[model samples]
Target: MKDFDLVIRNGTIVTSSDIFSGDIGIKRGEIKELGRNLSERAEDVYDAKGKYIFPGGIDAHTHLDMPFGGTFSSDDFNTGTKAAAIGGTTTIVDFAVQPQGKTLNETIEMWREKADGNACIDYGLHLAITQMNDKTREEIPQVIRDGYSSFKVFMIYEGMMVDDLTFMEVLDIASENNGLISVHAENPFVIDYFTKKLLESGKTAPKYHEISRPAYCEGEATNRAISLAKMTNAPLYVVHCSCEESASEIKKAREEGFPIMGETCPQYLLLSRDNYEEEGFNGAKYVMSPPLRDKKNWNYLWKALNDGVLQTVATDHCPFFMKQKRMGLDDFTKIPNGAPGIELRMALMYSYGVDKGNISIEKFVQLTSTNVAKIFGLYPKKGSIVVGGDADLMIFDPEKKVKISKDILHENVDYTPYEELELKGYPVATFSRGELIAEDGEYIGSENRGEFIKRSGPKII
Candidate 1:
């Protein structure tokens, strides 16, 4: 008889704090032991001699089977989770949005239906409060009790942007319930103004997407949103912050002790507005909201990542194929606003941020996994690789390389924005609850193996 269900041997274990050579023993899906050596026998054993064992990534922001602008994103729960697994992520918390005049519960039920038997990894949901009423406000506590510790509100979008009063109420309700709020910060009026001007001049190309949504629009809205959080005395998380202007304000707000947090995506850090200038319709692939900022803003974002202004990194993993993005071939406004990135976040960040000496190993773990767990109530359980923790881990090859290519990637999309961008690090093996889901860039996972998680109330680390 085996002492444990599985054993990871001779691996360098890296956690939020320290790194050391050791072995991990797993039993029934949770970590049973961790130390230099163990004489236990197991039915399955992995010799991780040259790899670094870390907690499997938690991609807290993802949109699988999301519908937008008359078309649905390409990846459904099935393909997105598989891509996440191969990219070293073990779990994802996708957004659930209520349609106009609908209840939060109904939307969650819809998303749950999509994820129930299709996802190959654990998942959670964050309510996107698009409209509010007495009933919506009343539903807050139940949502919190149901393990959804976070909520999202949009600052810009026709038929979706909540009023200041609604935004403030969301802040008050979430804070009162120990829940956090994430805002998509962009000035809708500013975007409307520029969009009209650009089109008025016949500037309908994809490049105009960035031209209309400038950094100032995001910065102004960020400042405004933080001020509202202060008024309500609520904790705020600004999602997809893409410019130096926004980071600077967030830094100042944090210095003033306003309980504000900032999040940015790999696209903002790795790509820039220059991508929008790609010839013909090629630039449409990079057309995400808070569209990629200028190269000059890169310094500030990188500094913020290391300087404490930004608290987390997420993919906002929403994708649309070239054909979908081409919906706006004659009108930029019709372009679907996202690109394929669920599979490249880890490797791209490691190759760009770590190998370039921009952030320490511990910081990388925290940004990609730890901080997300702590913020969304999955810490210690999903973020750490320790005894008594879930056996969700990734064995990474620090020297392995992969050039971003759609043909070889698994985002269910036809193109990758970072095509030909080579990364020196990659996941060799990914395990969720001691079950091997991916190995050496190939998915060996079982369908419907995922379960919905119960998250704790909001609290920051």
Candidate 2:
């Protein structure tokens, strides 16, 4: 019998906390060894002579075919996970939203069916709690025990927003179950007031979307979420935080020993308000909630990432075509509140982050994979390349260069927020559980092969 099924040799292995050159041996879809080459028979061997081997990315946030704003997101699990594989992301934790009056379990099952036979890689789910009724509260602990340990609550949306009282209740209940609560932190009233004012003044341009949801809208809500966490002793995640005000609030909370964390995205790190002012309808393509802020905010966010103030980076990967985005040509609110980037995240973070010296290679792995796994309860099983760990790995060509354009990506969306952005460094090959799925931006994997990751309760690092 062969000692190992496959061996990836001679690459710089970068993990969350260490970087070294070695070889990784795989067998039975798990990493079986990590050391200098040994004389062992194998079914296959890959020579990664001048590359880097890291844990495949884990995009903890993405929306695949999620119905919103009168239309479903363009990329379903089929296309989204394919895109993720091609981009070297081996796992995704998409959020499953609950419709009002629906049971929490029902929402999870509905999303499970959607992704069951479609996902090309492994996946987990974060239950988006839209209702806070007695039954929903009563079911929280059981749901956590059932492996859906992380849940999201929005602070700003019609028919979705949970009031402060409800937010507190969620925090308290989630705490009791050791569940983590991620908040979409934004003050709805402030946004509504400004949105109405902008409409009245005929300032209905896409730029008004940013103006209406200013940094303070997120900052105020971030602080409020932190307060609830403190009072309930619950871990809080401020999702899609885009500005200095919100980052500052989260930073203060963490410094004060509160279990508060912040998550930002490539859009906030790279793009800014200027995109909303792009000529004509181009602006609508970047119209995600808590819209991009001034470029200055990007500076603060990068600093936060490097300084450990922010713990995770994810793409709220929802896509809408230009035709779909055009639905709001006369009114910004009608446009779907998202942009596509599921397949572009790892490349951008590696090229733009590690190559530019904005962050170290090990830190990049943490921001993209390991930290996410630890927080959401998939640590050694999903994030690291170690003995007895799943063989979710990526072989990256450090010298390879890639240019971002929707034409080259696998996402079903028509346009990309990072279109025309060129970057150095790309993943040449990706493996999910020892299975070679994608290489050189093309997928060779079968759909519906992904299994749902039933996670444990919060393990906040």
Candidate 3:
């Protein structure tokens, strides 16, 4: 009789701290054993010679079926999570927004209804706090107790931006309740001034999007957010950090021993502001928040990842179709601000970040998988390959190459921002809780197989 449900043999298993060649034994949806040449019989076995086995990546930032700019994001949970698995990510922590006048529980229940029967892999939620009243403030501790331990606050968006007092109140409440606050750090007023000046000058083009939101806008807001966290003695996480100016502020705060963490997306590291000049509206595909900076900022962010200045790399996977982008044909501000990247983060990081000698294989796992889990309270359970942990993993072929194109991708969008970008390493198979979900660039899993993860409070790593 087979003693295990599955056995992955002859694979080089990797983690954030070490790399070794071994076989893994899994049963009942959890890792059962780890050893060399495991002699136990199994119902099924996969030979992974010459391939690398990595713990399934955990993307900490994603907006699935989200409403923005008069329409919802193109990829809903079903398509979004499938694309994430095909890209080697087995779990995702998506944002759940609280509409005005809605309570915290209502917000979570609404998002749950959207993802309950559609998500393909395990998922969690981080509440985006839009309204902070005496009632909402009272709900923070209970919400944290209910397994959602992180909340988001925007500094720039019109309906989402919180004033300084509200932001401070959030920091204070989260600190006392042991939850973490992630911020979208960009100064709205500064952006408004620049945008007004550019529009009056008749510079209405996609390129003007980058011009209206400069690096300083992000830098100033980053510093201000950090200062507020310091005053409240709260831990803060700055999301989608784009340029050296913002990274510099984060590094300085960390040096001063403040509880601060920073994350940068793959778009910021691989693309540049010049994308805004992509021969007219073609640039609209690259229009995202904290707009891509000068090419010079790339190396600094890369170096920050290797030097421990930045802790995680996430996709900020929010995609919109070209039809939605064309809404701003005459006015740059009307363009929906997001691009598809959930399916490209892993390969892009491996090709440019690791293959180019910018980071080691271990550090790659740390930035893309391990640190994210640790920061967001899913470590060991979702981020590590260990006995008793969930059997979420990926088989990566290091030598296989693929040229990215929208036709070959699975995202429910009409175009891919990473069109024609070749990548050297890619995931060939992905497993979630002992079930094969994706293999060879195709999704083969059953619908509604993913479960909602109950996460604990954040762990300081």
Candidate 2 residue-wise lDDT, 1-461, digit = tens: 88888888888999998989988889999999899874265678888889999999999999998988889999999989999999989999999999888999999889999999889999999998887888998899999988999999999878788998888988899888899999999999999899999999898778888999989988998888898889888889888889998999989988898888878999999998999889997899989998999999978898999888999899999999889999999998888899998888898998889999899998999999999999899988999888999999988988897777778888897788898999898989999999889988899976679999899976776
- In TM-score terms, candidate 3 sits at 0.99
lDDT of 1 by residue, 342-373 (tens): 88888887889888888888888888888888
In model 2, pairs of residues that clash are 117-448
lDDT of 3 at 365: 93
Error of 2 at 30 (Å): 0.3
| lDDT-based ranking | 3, 2, 1
- The C-alpha TM-scores of every prediction are 0.99, 0.98, 0.99
Q: For candidate 2, what is the lDDT? A: 0.90
* Model 1: lDDT to the true structure: 0.89
Runs with alpha carbons beyond 4 Å of true place in candidate 3:
none
What CA root-mean-square deviation does each model show from the true structure?
1.0, 1.0, 0.9
Candidate 1 regions exceeding 4 Å error are: none
Per-residue error at 291 for model 1, in Å? Answer: 0.5
Per-candidate clash tally:
0, 1, 0
Which 10 consecutive residues of model 3 have the lowest summed lDDT?
36-45
